[model samples]
Target: MPTWLTPEGKALSCLEKIKVLNENLTEIRELCQEALEDAVLMGCDEPQVRQVLQELLDSLETPFENK
Candidate 1:
């Protein structure tokens, strides 16, 4: 007999997906931070830098359920 996707199977898949997404989001945040730092070094306006960082912060917020 074939094994079916019980509740445990579903939870495992969800956990894996969240883990991958979390890693990707963290990397994106770091890249955004680096970009903002480079802009600062180039003497970009403070307000523009803040706006870019804020957008990155927003994207990092996940709506996933806590285990």
Candidate 2:
């Protein structure tokens, strides 16, 4: 589990929010791990697969903006 932090560098304090966040992360991790394993078994380059995943994450856009 990670100590999720806010943009201001403070640790997240809401238990319900933290639980949801951690659960979401766990689900993503499991899915990604399965995909990585499948790719490796199919002879795909592990590093390339990882790079693509990172790029996908980097390309995400959020509609919410702080005012």
lDDT of 2 by residue, 1-67 (tens): 9998998889999999999999999999999999999999999999999999999889999999853
Best by TM-score: 2
lDDT of 1 by residue, 1-67 (tens): 1222444565334566667777887887788778878998999987889897788667886587645
TM-score of each: 0.54, 0.87
Residue pairs with clashing backbones, model 1: none
What is the alpha-carbon lDDT for the whole of candidate 1?
0.71
Whole-model Cα lDDT per candidate? Answer: 0.71, 0.94
Model 2 misplaced stretches (Cα beyond 4 Å): none
